[model samples]
Target chain A: MNIRGLSLETIPPIFTPFRFFLSAPLSGILAAILLIYSGTDIWLTRWNINNLALTHLLTIGFMLIVMLGALYQFIPVMTGQLIPGSKKLASSIHIMISLGVLTLVTGFLSHSRIFFILALFFLGIGLCLFAGSLLPLLIARLQNQLIVFLLRILYLVLMVTLGLGLYMLLAHAVPSLEIDFRNYTDLHVLWGLAGWIVLIIMAISSQVIPMFYVTPEFSRNYLKMLSLAILITLVSLSLYQGGYIKALEVLLTLELLIFVVYTLHLIGQRKRKIADVTIYFFRLSLVSLLVGIIIWWLGRYLAQQTFYFLLAIVMIYGLAISAITGMLHKIAAFLIFLHLQKLSLSRPTAISLVPNMKQVISSQNSWIQFMLFLLSYAFILVSVFFPQLTVLAGVFMLLSFSWLAYCLFQAIRRYQKIQLEILALPEMKMSI
Target chain B: MAREIILDVSELEPPQPFEEVLKQLRKLQAGEYIKMLHRKQPLPLIQLLHENGYAVSMSNSPSGLWEIIIWKMSDPVSAADCNTQFGTNIIQADVSSNR
Candidate 1:
């Protein structure tokens, strides 16, 4: 593939992506706080309002929001097509989604139809604008079949998730619909978690691991086959309920296992054996994936719903959060430095003002956060089995996310500071 | 004869490759150009070159290697001379002036 065809011309302003990155940890902070306030009761069952609120807090507020940010960033790099009116689109999308998530979380907590109504309106318009905006661009790009394929599915499943989500919201908003929320709940989680989130993880990791880590590129045909397998299994999973389909039973776990092995192997073989913090996060993510599988496997044998709770904890807190944090460390640092570098270029005197990658977020600071994250993960895992210690887990989680927000904020703060100094220079000949 | 500093960063990762080029560009004098051999297109590096008052010539060799030749546009070089010496893969060889 002519990867260079991916142009920098379309890169949205630094704030466009940074705003989303910055918001993720804030969402994590809220999730952590909720985990604390909800207490051990959340560990009892997945359907409880407290647990549901916590789930959306992480899923929609944290994970999906970051993914949405990445969508804006990646579309330009992958396809070389700029969103025609990105600034306004991004601003509006950000506001709507922010409101939508707030209302949705409030709806869950209060069990209020009004909040649900407001959430559906906000998210519906927000998600539709997001989907509507992206659809045209992805359809136009045909160069790299793999990326185009991944992006198209990401769009489709997002809409699918949105549709199911809206339908569920309607059931809540209009009580006369008599919709059995329980029946669709399984399908909703399956599509949202596996089809949308996991596949996106697959799509992104396949490229990033190789490119960023200097690992061997995963075989194209192999990845295509893997993606196809995921698609087929997701369809089978939703359709077949009479008897558990073998592929459906095994595919999600099997795919994750394969991914873990594949990624670990690639990381092991990377050209530079550097002891970087991002590498540490990736390792933690892989290890978390393994633990998640183990927890899930153990869930099958347990009569108590505690194991299910453990599995979710391992997946969300341990796996998803670890990977997202790692990627953010690199991405936030890169974009900040790149923008600084660009700004510093106009005046040669400003060259010295630009911070190196490490200086943006020190290895020491990131390491501290990483360790805290691991500690938080450990406590969360233990809390599932030992509910009394749940408060402590929430503290660790809060500390970790707060540190994360700080570190991300530092990079942005530094960027703004340096950018101001550069702009103040006399005879500034260029502008981004 | 023109001066050339040939540096190969095929084995280095990320900011390393970009940093190596910046280091060369720092002490570079008039009529002296840096020819960098990299494994992939340094997109960020290219963007920096575009932003800064620098002239850049990037040619992807048939072996899937990238040979990037850049110099300060203030200290100009002739495109005709560069094209003859650097082979045919040069895309947007802004050697004579800035964009």
Candidate 2:
């Protein structure tokens, strides 16, 4: 636990976080492409096993993968503590988790019980290892009020999601369990989206938004209130599913309104006033959130499956992916900078080892990705009503995802080159 | 005449616990000066001191160690005044020579 020994080389600390960060978005791009290739009609046919697979491709593959990566990076910085497990243990966990995600997605699509069981086993081990590494650091650093509170809540919700997943898998394997799939599935989505995703976003936004823009501190009171409201509403919805749906919807609407206000306030207060690609993503995501709510409201009134499908597409593809992409741009650059800064202290003259983040990811690429994403989304919306344009929507989505993956891959290669430069430094000269 | 007060704090960490260190720095007589030596960059501490109405100057030693000197603005008139008033070397001696 010696501070000096916690160097980058000794721990290879950045590896998993970087890997996960790159992998999550790239997998997401691939998932998006897969959904598009399947055609809008097939993608929206929720009863189809392929639809479930496509959903998990985004949810488990892209969302959870990236979320876990961010968690690993943020937890240490947030708590001022290192991850508990050994490097070997962490690498193994990463491998298992990657394999598990692939297997589970494949199994769910094919309805292969063996793959399902194996996926469950691998994923469970990986998640347990991750939780084990994080939970202790959280407990020891309970003094950081924001971090401790968010981490605790996130962990609990993760457990709930995992539990539901386990039960669903079990139900698939054993019919006698007699669990209602619809009932648990709603709880599962609730925990996954509202609990895990939203809570983490709340926690991270507090730190990142201020830091990135060098803005004045956000109203801590407002953030805390929002967090509490979201947490309470989610919990209530989980417990009282049918009865609390209306109330939950109201709460969600209020939360979204607050978020929009907060985001506007942040942008207004930002030191750098110029528009950035990440900001574009943030704006798109917020718009998507608003649109998704409207679609949900419409679905409630009309009871149309198309509206529900539109809601999912907007929320998942438009909002979630945009926000995640925006975040990755900043987080990846920051991590690379942090590592380089640390390295520079040891090897000040080592061939100028820092990566130019601006060059690594271009605004043009981001804009292209964003436009393609919107085009695909528009196609999907059109297809839901028209059904004929589904194939075209699918094609657009596939192209957008492919472009995103390429952009991410280029960024990662830049990261690797920077790592190599550091490695090439002599032992005496190079810092961890 | 601006006066110099020397504070030899060679034992602080980077982004030094500024409030705690400031309390000791503030106790200097209105015309005295202080100098601190620390291993890491003292940018945060220097900024904190400046914000609290202290005039400060910073230089790095030949070995890349930090030397921060602080003085009350009201007392200093001449370089000689600083040198003779404190009865101690206003200019820091090379510590690497001893090493």
The most accurate candidate by lDDT is 1
- For all predictions, the C-alpha RMSD in Å is 3.5, 10.2
> Mind giving the per-residue lDDT tens digits that candidate 1 earns over B54-77?
656676677767888876656545
Candidate 2: list runs displaced more than 4 Å: A1-12, A241-245, A351-353, A418-432, B1-99
Error of 1 at A202 (Å): 2.2
Write candidate 2's Cα lDDT for A29-67 as tens digits. Answer: 556556656664564456667677777778777777787
Give the C-alpha miss distance for residue A62 in model 1, angstroms.
Answer: 0.8
Number of the top TM-score candidate? 1
lDDT of 1 by residue, A69-99 (tens): 8877766555655564677798788879888
Q: Name every residue pair that clashes in candidate 1.
A: none
Candidate 1 chain A TM-score vs. reference chain A:
0.94
Place model 1 in a CAPRI quality band: acceptable
RMSD of candidate 2 to the true fold? 10.2
Candidate 2 structure, TM-score to reference:
0.75
Q: lDDT by residue for model 2 over B1-99, one digit each (tens)? A: 655444544433111233235545546665556666644333334433443344545556786456666664454453335445433423232223210
Report the Cα lDDT for residue B79, model 1: 38
